[model samples]
Target: MQDAPRTVTFGPKRFCFGRRTYVMGVLNVTRDSFSDGGRYLAFDRAVARAEEMVEEGADIIDVGAESARLEAEKLDPAAELERLLPVIEWIARHLEVAISVDTYKSVVAEAVLQAGAHIINDISGLHEDPEMAGVVARHGAGLVVMHLQGSARQPARQPRYDDVVAEVTAYLQASIQTARQAGVAPDRIMVDPGIGVGKLTEHNLALLRELPRLKALGHPILVGHSRTSVIGNLVDAPIGDRLEGTLGATAALVALGVDVVRVHDVRANVRAARVADAILRGWTPPWPWAFDAVTGEQRRPLRSLRELARQD
Candidate 1:
């Protein structure tokens, strides 16, 4: 089958895939993010975490003021602004990487975009407020349209699939059209498969495996399975111990050509992506590594080239 169309032609940044995996580090400024709750609630702590991610080679930083886990309540507009405004400014002033604000509220989206955020990573996909489309369009910011099952309260009921993959592709396609109709440009959009919100375990796995299928919708895909119970179940590990599983999934996702990885352990995922990217970077080495038949030994490496030649 033909692969889906792809473009990262958003404003100020063009996200071409296969050059390398783009790592989006998680920075939850709230006290209730399901996985890393309370860890970075303090402003200084959050900023420190963002700095750490940057040092660890994060390509983007995603700041969220509310946890979308379960019936997680939405942050009131004023509090949301109070929490993220300085964080956005701090990152903009200090880090050279892109910043994606994770909010579905129009108010929060507008405020952060004004405060120097480059993208609006909405989990609701413009379903929550019609005005969100306008805010994004006005600022000319990039958006992530995720396939959520439902709001945290309403929640997606079950796998109502006449083929979940096809349905999701259609939904995202229509969403892109909807945003465009409402004035958001096509190039400024990205689609996400909405991993855990309402998908069954099997449904989530299927979406992860077939993420490329969603490409037919014609936008970049951001796969976020980091520290989610999805990885936990895959390895039969608990939340705190799923680091290996998370990195493993990230490895597979990059190999499959997914565009961006939203992750918790930014440094580790960066390593997995770097290795996977070396193989997928479109040029083969003159020869494969030699293998010994006596003990099936592989002569891999004791040394490697570490940095890219500086780009002018």
Candidate 2:
């Protein structure tokens, strides 16, 4: 485990690791997203969805114009900017939600940010673009840097790691160097371990289990395991049925003191986080959930949503 990073503020939200779990709701502005495809493809619908995520207790809204799922091609800068900027503008003008533009292209970032988005949730870190770090720095925007082990097109398979923890920690340290050297304030950057984008299941699990190891990098850790295939494989379920796995993963991260979780099922995750936060903060249980949601029967371990949402 590593020392926690300094507390940082993103717009009006302030987070210090070990305090509370921050939820980042996914608002895919695309027609082919793997999880919520076409759910928010229209600008008005996307804006409304962003508003609802805020109402659902999401602390941040992650807007993505391209689907980075398997074989998810990168969106060209112009089209991607065209798809995201309007929604960002509407969110910024209407809601107090802190919007995160999910793109690796500096061009798209520049345009959407100019429209008032507050953060850059780039999956490739700064490895994908020459000017991304500078753009973040110039705007003093928040940054989410992730570690990827392969090309843009392939999942990270059999990624070589003499020491996965040490290697990832060092890479993040170096990326922080790149960020600060490019004028990005050291306090404004957050790090994600690239949960599923390029990592295999073992790699993803290792990163999650050893997430405390990442705090040594001196930045908040962002865990995005919600509805990912890694959870599906673990529970033998499809994308829609991995809520329990998602809840378990978020609980584990909260136990490890991770700062944020990027998720799709915000309501369930909000419930789970409430319970986990109570346990971590030494608070009382919210509900005595010794039974199931629909039926009043004693459930098995980790079965009740309210039980899952209350202190153990």
TM-score of each model, paired residue for residue: 0.86, 0.86
Query: In model 1, which residue pairs have backbone atoms overlapping below 3 Å?
Result: none
Output the worst ten-in-a-row residue range by lDDT, candidate 2. Answer: 303-312
Which residue runs of candidate 1 sit more than 4 Å off their true CA positions?
Answer: 1-14, 152-154, 157-159, 283-312
Write down the lDDT of every candidate, Cα atoms only: 0.78, 0.80
Q: Tens digit of lDDT per residue, candidate 1, span 1-312?
A: 223334454323446554556788999988778888889889899999998887776777899988887756667889989989999999888866689999889988989998999999988777777788889999988898887767633567664666778877777877788789878878778788888777888888888888878867766678899988788888998889999999999888877777889999988998788777777654232444456758778876422211121110
Measured by C-alpha RMSD in angstroms, how accurate is candidate 2? 5.8
- Deviation of model 1 at 223, angstroms: 0.5
Per-residue lDDT of candidate 2, residues 87-158 (tens digit): 888888887667898888898888888899889987777877889999999989999988877754454556
Q: Show the colliding residue pairs in model 2.
A: 156-198
Which 10-residue window in model 1 sums to the lowest lDDT?
303-312
RMSD of each: 4.8, 5.8
